[model samples]
Target: MKMKTRGNFQLQRVIGYFHGTIILFSIIIGAGIFLAPKGVLKYSSLNVGVSLSIWAACAVVSMVAALSHAELGTTFPRSGAQYYFLKRSLGPLISFSYIWVNLFASPAGTAARSLLLAGYIIHPFYPGCSVPEMPKKCLALAIVWCLGILNARGVKEVTWFQTLSTVVKMAVLCFISLTGIVLLVRGRKENLARFEKAFDAEVPDASQIAEAFLQGLYAYSGWGVLVRIAGELKNPGENIPKCVITALTLVALIYLLVNISYLAVLTPKEIMSSDAVAVTWMDKVIPSMQWAISIGVSSSIFSSLNCTVFSSSRVLYVASQEGQLPLILSTLNVHSCPVVAVLQMTILASFIIIPSDLILLVNYVGFIDWLQLGLMMTGLLKLRFQEPDLPRPYKNLWQLILVLLAGRLLRDTFLHYATVSLYVDPLKKILSNICIRNACVSRQFI
Candidate 1:
């Protein structure tokens, strides 16, 4: 067994703080904002206050997990985050298995969301637009293929596009937020009263509230994409934590404010029942701006798809480089991107889109992600004890606090799994299939 070493393929460090922040933000903000409001309202009775609170709470929990990962990313500063941490802190088999699961689950989830976005984009023009009956899978496959080609060509080639798309999406969101405030101040008394009533509604059953909270949590997922690119970011130690925490904070604020905008324009019941809440709210408030919101959603989803494909390929490529996967996957093109790994991920993601199960995929990937995060947080604690002298750029004194939070998140994840198993058995079956398929694919590659 020849020992593997970092050879001629020096990892690219082209991404700066702005690119890093937007990349992380875009990955977290995709599709969820559109899908989550309805679920939040459904379970929470359109109680805007409770819904916003849930988003905040989820963001806090996710941020702690992000900070924990920041310490680990800085300590390792390697390509494969969880893979590297698990290998160094635990062992190779565990690390490889986690990467295997991620390759199948995470990219698939991202692609599934992209396809769902595509469905929404085409719906206005097509009228009969639906996920299952439409050519959404083909459209999603085309997106994956295009992004894979761009990634294969080079990261530099795609970075500008990522930056542009992110800017456009943010601009749209800002416009919406500002416009909402303006409309509210213009004395839309009836709308304001409706929103207030919605916010102050009686709490629903405990189970319903819990379910809504979980949905909100899912919307706030994907903060870990920051750690996924630790190897590629400039000044991983200082920038990793800063970028993750800042992005989460901004995301939390945007979610709260935007949901407030939705409440201001539409009643809780309307927000809950609508398929496209953002577009619907825009239609009501400023009907002519429907195209703007649609374009924004499309751009945001596209950027997210690009970033996720880029990050996930790196994860698999690193695993391959470490001998946890087939060496073919580690091969880099002239652009220094992992062509084989990108292709493999795109193929798996295409399958996810074909099935038209975005919600199922999100929950399924989220379940495993929460588990991985708990393990990552535990890894942080272990590193502090075992390698006390390691040069850590950022250290958190709240280790015990983070550990307790991780424990609670772990329990929450397990309970979530149990609840889904008991009530939504079909969802449980889909998740099982995802796990089994991932295992089989990774074994084949190895």
Candidate 2:
């Protein structure tokens, strides 16, 4: 592991492979599955078969990308996943670009998830009307502060919450899957008929298919969590790959099965009309237990927001160690948590709530994620060619990963550009500052 960064503060390696798997699994399987199945199915043109196929294909692509990241994690065995990888292989400028962009983007993501949790909590109050933004923002900031405080408490407490949240998420999903299974066991094969002619419907066009793939991929976007916190894991060289592979595979299977259950139990109209598909599914199947699924969904989003705060702080801490940022972020509190780093992230997220356009902020900033991943892919290949004898414990499987990501980048670029078309006026104003901000962000201290 590279500790060349000047810091006496060290993170304890308390996360064993099993707990590591739990944490990664919880992060990757966020509120997306509960809410996204409908959008994925809708975007796939309501073809049950095509929708399932898209889910499966997205899982495969995610697995490949994650394994490639595992290879990088094992090779580098460092805390700041993309930051460290790019700095070592691609050069500091590219690495700094990653950290700099993330400085803005990561908070948007954190804020978005916390706001989503707020929306979930508040929706019941105002049934049909749009949930007011001011209250959501207030609740969202509160949740961010609470989760950040939890993170500052200790890593053990944080991971323990992750375990509890993951268990709740899995239990809710399993309940949904089990209901479908029970129907099949009772000779109720009617819902299973949805997949009879999978691709028979009007298939989505190239652009639409690309958009649907984006939705599916978004649900699987957090597969690289193990690599992000590699330094804190026990035996990172051996365990990083194991945890990434295992967690992604399990989440993929769970997602597939959960989607299958949805198709089986709900009518096409029911699936399409309801935004919260799980809640609707539970309403019809077991009306009495609706609150349980709701709580589970809340936990799902909460855990994800918790993880964003927990992990993104590490980037600040690592950069501090590397002397790219103030030394305050490098120090740990009595709980062995990166208190300043966590609070920095938490406060940033709090401020981002001022924008009523977080969804747009998240969409706009998501380009950086693709850019970083593409860098890691290319950089790792470059590293291999440059240092052929470099000790690589986990082998990569990403020739296809690059091609797939390149296609996603181009496709997302087009779709994202089209999305920005609606906000061309505002986007133009925001675009003006991007170049200057990107260059100057790397030099900012404190």
Which ranges of candidate 2 are over 4 A from the true structure? 1-7, 126-130, 184-190, 354-366, 418-446
Which residue pairs collide, candidate 2?
none
Candidate 1 on 164-203: residue-level lDDT in tens?
8888888877877787788788877875786556456777
Worst 10 residues of 1 by lDDT: 124-133
The RMSD of every model to the true structure, in order and in angstroms, is 3.6, 3.6
Q: Candidate 1's error at 299, in angstroms?
A: 0.4
User: What is the TM-score of each predicted model, taking all chains together?
Assistant: 0.89, 0.89
Identify the leading candidate in terms of lDDT: 2
The CA lDDT of each predicted structure is 0.74, 0.76
